[model samples]
Target chain A: MTHRTIKPAPNIVQGTPLDAKALKRGKIFLNSYAPALRYTWDTGEAMGRYLAELKNGRLIARSCRKCERVMIPPRMFCERCFRPTDDWVYVKATGTVNTFSLCYVSWDVRRLKQPEIPAVIEIDGASPGMGILHLVRKVAPKDVRIGMRVAAVWKPPAQRTGSITDIAYWMPINRRSQRTVSAK
Target chain B: MNERVAIIGVGVMAARPSSEHLSFKEMMFEAAQKAYADAGIDAHEVESFVTCAEDLTEGISIFDEYTPDQLGAVQKPMHTLTQDGLYGIADAVMQLRSGLVGLVVVEAHSKHSNLENPNSILNYALDPVYNRPLDFNPHVIAGLEMNGFLHATGITQAQCAQVVAKNRTHALKNIAAAYPMNLRAEDVQSSPYLCYPLRDAEMAKSADGCVVVVLAGASRAQPSKSRPVWIRGVGFTNDSPTLESRDWIDAQYIRAAAAMAYGQAGIKDPVAEIDLFEVDDAYAYKELQHLVALGIYPQAVAAGRAVENGESGAAGKMPVNVSGGSLGIGHTLEASGLYRLAEIVCQLRGEAGPRQLPRAKVGLAQSWRGVPTTSGAVVILGR
Candidate 1:
């Protein structure tokens, strides 16, 4: 039996002939039956709920039930022990910048966009090794490097909301004693 | 021991830029039917089907929508892999190894001519977080890899052009080949640069076509309708998705894949063991880089001597791209592997009219998924 081939009309109504072949600017129908992918934040819920605490100017982490290892960003499951986590410990908002890349492009291609530097920082008061992916502000793209000490600059208490973006990118925290000592 | 699968038949639809007369399914069925006819097996004879396909967003909705039934795969265990065509072939090899199924059909189609912006469509394959944000044209990744390949291997631009000239020359013998032209180093050099160090002429022209092959277990009674090319071995691998992460100097994925496949095929030296090759030259420079990865081209100014030996033609050392490869036959993405499979099977059967190789016993075909993911596969076919 012969299968009838399906062809759709040209999608791009305007454009110069692409090649010397003199072919019409057209569309082909692709029939895909693969199962669709659906995802839920099964593990991200604790991180989301803990991050919800940040709106009130508080940091929280989950302590592993078996290993007693602290997980930042409060995940529901512990990676090391392979067990569920329940201990919600509050911590301070001080951490060091782990690594970062200065991005100069935007998702939208139409407009000329400014440089945006997205960085991954390890939050203070959370587990020493735990890290979060966010942005860094008030620093030259070139000046950004690994191990740069930065502190979270939260919004006013009443204005605080449970979100990473609420911190408005970490700022360089200057140590006066270290600066003066280095000067001597 | 599980039964070894043998490709009992192979067929390819004539590749073209735009098949105004045929739909993608029609084109696929054309090749599938021809393969069934060649194998003397009806669609009902096959136990399952595997097709290589991408999202409908590339064309219209229902991507695997028109396959199966159209390819005569109705009511069987059919599955479509959203991967490169050759990977789908690798999947078939796995299915046959399980011993649950004896016969399987693998089909891949390319209707590139349908896309408005092929580059934009290609960008979707990149890491959404980093590479895609920069909106890197997929060719740039190849361009970067080619630069590293040339610098590390010392294969010169001229050698790259020679690869093109030889492949196109061999393609001239392929009736189904769409871009069979007698090219010269100067001709390729003069073509505009799509990306630095890569010329427009060097790139494989995208086309619309279908290629399908019918493979059955070796333990099954021989059909005798057509000679079978046993699947000696199959190898496929994917490299780091981030271009920044890998040592671009070598196509580690291709080398690793080749080793696994060559080992399984009991081939210690591909240059000596493989009688002919069907290299996936999506871009002319890719042939040089991939040859190096396959451990064939070892220098900057590679003695593309093997390519120019006239062996890849009708009679001439280890003919490569005798069906013209993607360079001459046009790269149909998913269908390209089947095209390579068809040529190898035909050559081994002494059925490649005018393009047949002399005393060809073994065939090797290698393909790389274009970019973002430096993924590739290598397969060795034996009679």
Candidate 2:
């Protein structure tokens, strides 16, 4: 048989579209409440250590002896092998871009004057595909690629805080780049 | 099993971009009233009720406290599922199969326009130390996953655009579809990018909506307004919640969920057995990746050929997202899966109008929890 009953129109339109003028007038406003909820998260044993190393200008990772997978932003246990990490390892500060996005807007939906190149950089010492979500800098947004090599541009030691932002942002290793002394 | 669950009636309402006409409670009431009336049953006959919603999406903590009043489910054996509406239906199926309840109603709704800061709200859902400090837009992860999925599957961005063109054009036939643009693959490519690879046009914009489905046991299936579509299989699973730890190539959770559902339905081959699919295509690339994950295509590489050859279209060999999907219709947060499920039920009952299939006996609906999480659900239904 051919089709019989077609479903009705999609939306349930009732009142007219509320314009900004009437909305701002607050004539029909019944209640007003702004939410402010706070939370305190324990960094746990693994992430707590990872943040401490970031504060000291180093990248930390953990290895699972069972499956031999190295993890960045280190974890206490291995997800696949189902075992606690067997060793602690420090991954290289420099890595390749696993993927990236040229964001024209901020998290709060505000358009940015300059687009931000946010990429997931796969740490050299971690597993082959494992990566961390962070920002890229010192390169034009158009020049960024999937496998581009980049190094972390850290904040000065005096200005460092125990946070992911301590690494300032990542910069592409261009031909004219100068070498910096390692933190021992 | 003793008996199968039946979906007798479904009610849904969605507005494009946003809905300024009605409040969230009013939206739920609209769907609830239609659903109950369609099922030829009243609110008093409903033994239990299941509502799907989340605290963060609604912006009001303990959101369920405000749900029951509108649905007329007050003081009954009512419960809530924080996940998608598919999960609520799955739970309701178990409740009815236990021979306890004769009638059950599952409800879910979305009010994203009211959210003050949706991005920050999503960021709060992320890990506090590693993810939040980067101040990343959640769409960036979708881009990253799109990269990994395509690189692993050898699917091109142009092919992904075909999915956008296919769905948006497919929406023209669906009256319920939200953003029905007359777009093509070139148009999708020419569109400005949202977060690299994932163009602003490809990602489904959130809209305000509600969905309610009435499920009655086979014994009580009589005295009904419409034919009951039996729930043949139901499955949902969780992969590693952390994106860093998951198999980023494809959705293992989807594979597992499909296996469970297909197993229950005695479906050895999905592409051959299932007539059509109504998956959560919140993003364009997701349709390609999910087809591979659901085992419709043997691997990700096979998806491109199918899409490019018009094999995944409404009249194609394997029709997918015929109700325009979330990309065509809007994604209604937790209610998305049920919205798709309702489409399948409508198609099986010969009620889908211009978008209906030639002959559909069995259909599948799949959904995934949005960004930074690897959890999904699947359900199968037939006439």
Candidate 3:
């Protein structure tokens, strides 16, 4: 189990970065491509209903009869119980923040003027720790904390578009309410 | 296991930042060509092929339909693994053990530089209805996970920054490393944040590369004059998909995968039996998390100390990522596993040049599919 005289070759190389301008100007010998890949995924039995509920300024989840757990951002099946969802339940609009980040980068990898506070909020009616990723706005990044109680602030019914954005953002549940109860 | 599987040959071609000379298909062909030559066999001799890729990364759906021709496996038994490079190699090892094939090829690569919107590509990987709509950089999850990891384990952010400093310093010896720098801990600690706890310097830069490994059964893989490296054990696992339900601090999937691989390898204590590691460090914090999961450290807090103490460096107790790893070497996405494996093979074969470990007998290669998922694979190699 030894290399008596094994030789090695370089695995990495320094290459000039491709210049798109050169390619566009016909100075480079390469082809250019732009992907227009698009798709409209079926929201399915659970999410279809979830989005519909969001448009009406309400939060919804599916109840798994087998496990007796409510999962938010609802799904058609109970992943743990391995069965189809048995019932639909409307969960509380407020949830506790499980984790959060002050993101200074945008979706396009650009720096942002204002850092976005994104957190995973576990809804009330959903099982404990059943959280969904969402933005928590109106609270200073330094003030956001794990286990903070936040409630969904929805857009006016006229502006609802059957999308997650229908809810403007999650706002910390009030200073007085935060001290009285733990995350449901 | 009735038979053994060995990596007979390895090939890697990396272009930092981008590859202007070759097309994606041509890149795959070039790496495959070198692997076939290294294996001392023609492309036709390789019975089956397993290619690693992701639809989102390639910006093409059904990438498999376009794979066979370049690898010279047209009309043969070729399948695809939508996983990291290490997972594909693990699958090839199983294929060899099944007795259905004497030889197999595992291929993976990252052509990320070609994507006009890599961040958007990553966003598509999130849970569509709930996660994708957040519209922030998909990397934000690393921050969340890092925050959780540090909070639960008491591993300080400064300690993680030390991981960055050490890895970048080690990368200096690696010609293939994209981020090799003469750096200090404070350099990374004071760097701009990508996600808190994850400084921009600590994050792996995207690099384009292809890796192909030729795997053969023990008998079929005779090393008449060359060295022989065998796959003693291989395993992969995926934890709960719900981010809320998982062990936020530890890499549970890595722990399971390492357990299975170590169990099969008959390894009792990794610190004593294993020679070195090339674990996933797509992010610096991940290196610590996976090490904790792999039993190198009893917990994250201890692992952080080991990192700060230089006990994990090449000259220390157990060397990790001596080939500079993905942090030093640019991360090659799906192909990262094979890149790590290639480094291990080079080390075990005693051909790793300046970074080669002395008297190294066994090595481990770890791979995580990256953020927004809780899946990972591990492979144990012994010579």
Candidate 4:
């Protein structure tokens, strides 16, 4: 292909410096210019309350009033229903791998120099369908298949927090024996 | 009442990834000016606004903060779609269809060069649960799709390379195209692999640019200085973002969108009805996948009948990617769709110098969001 050679026009405008060098320092400086953002959340609170249930080996979701659909990672409202959820429902922690990818790069070439395989898994239990975003470990990326059963692996009780990361990762659930290990 | 919506203006900036001089807003403003001038309308005349943006952490601190001032949309009804250019057009169309707004200005641009982890930012678009954890570069997904396309359709790598060569040749006439080079199939095949089966030349380089279009109602669409290419029909649909759940080889989302648009335009045979086409060739296989999906190429063509008959060019049945597409041009996110749209307008108005398809009366434009997501839109325009 013959690439177009662009000639810079004399009338082109300029802007404020992006501080390219300082950005490469990899450390925060005092009084560095950055934009401030303010956020509020009924959703955050719902997630907090829901994450609390996961530690006790339970999965919860919000059921919408208008559409009567359940939202995983429990939001206060349902997008499809366009209405507030009517009730909180508990779903099984087990699910199937919906889709996944094996990531080969790291941020700043940091820790875990090895790649990670991420996926979207649809949880099993409750109204027949709902998936949540989380990491899957203990199995090679190529060995994984869609619809393979998996279960949540929770962190130790002392390290528990009201967050999605509270579950260390999802491990392959042994369907042949229906065996699951309790939280570490 | 029938909706009278039309695109009354268009604008774009000279494309590049690391523009040393201008800010994102400056690039947008320059493009907006050209669109407004083409529409023969002032910025104040626009009743609503829809702008496309992505993560602010990628470049600016707040993503939406840079939109209003740049688009001249101060105090106007505006919404941000952190998606491709087609999404912005879809929003404007919906607002116009509701009889809620008459004149809407849509803006979309990308300034991705400043980000340190640009590849990671693209990966973030994947489903964080399964897809992102794998550390998969989204380009690999394109490879898989292309592999499937080749395996199923019997299309060779050389044929795919021909697409690149043809598109770049078409783009040589386009003033705004960033990488308009005369390339050969052998050269493209021998290039370094970004992802298996997809070489360096096959991928569209990240370029920073702005594209804006003024969409207006019927009365405002009356031709002034430049002919207004009417948007006859618009179609958009999204497939399961979960990649494993869908057929990666087939572009169902684009097919569905194209069906809706072609149906609305009363087009039963796209090959015969459409004159020119601008497909989302964000990846090499996408153009062929979309072509097959739209039924522009049927099973017989899939079996190599079309190539043997000397009917492979877009002008053979329907000329595709006449503006050289995102492949020859550049995929500046939201800017890409409007760039396709502008090319169609220019073609219909006989303004395209070398790329002007003879007797072009109608055109189709399509776009696909890159990876883990399959959101797409198709629009049919008429002179």
Q: Among the candidates, what TM-score does chain A have in each?
A: 0.66, 0.83, 0.81, 0.70
lDDT of each: 0.74, 0.82, 0.83, 0.74
TM-score of chain B of each: 0.94, 0.97, 0.97, 0.94
Candidate 2 lDDT for residue A115 = 92
Interface RMSD of each: 21.7, 20.1, 18.7, 17.8
lDDT of 4 by residue, A55-143 (tens): 66578987877776777877654434223457888877778888877777765665564568687888765444568878889897778
Lowest lDDT sum, 10 consecutive residues, model 3 chain A, at A175-184
Report the lDDT tens digits of candidate 1 across residue range A38-96: 21221135646676787766678888768767778675545344335778887666667
Candidate 2 residue-wise lDDT at B117: 71
Candidate 3 residue lDDT tens string, A1-184: 9869967867988787777787788886643334334433334355577888988778888888888898887765454543356788888888899999999999999999789998999988799888878999878888999999898887888888999988788889886663212221
- The digit string of per-residue lDDT tens for model 2 on B1-383 reads 45778998788785456665555765776788788778877766788989999887776678778677667776778878889899998898999999988889999987776766777777767776566667679778889888888888899999989888888788888877677777889998998998887888889878777899999888877635558998999999999878677787888888899998999899998888899998878888988888899988766688898888999999899998888788888877898898889899889988989988997999999998888778889999988
Model 2 interface RMSD over true interface Cα atoms: 20.1
Candidate 2 lDDT by residue in tens digits, A53-140: 9889999998988878999878765545433577889888888899999999999999998899999999877999888899998798
- TM-score to native of every candidate shown: 0.65, 0.67, 0.67, 0.65
Candidate 4's chain A scores what TM-score?
0.70
Worst 10 residues of 4 chain A by lDDT: A34-43
Clashing pairs in 3: none
Candidate 4 to native Cα RMSD, angstroms: 23.7
Clashes of each: 19, 0, 0, 32
DockQ of all candidates, in order? Answer: 0.01, 0.01, 0.01, 0.01
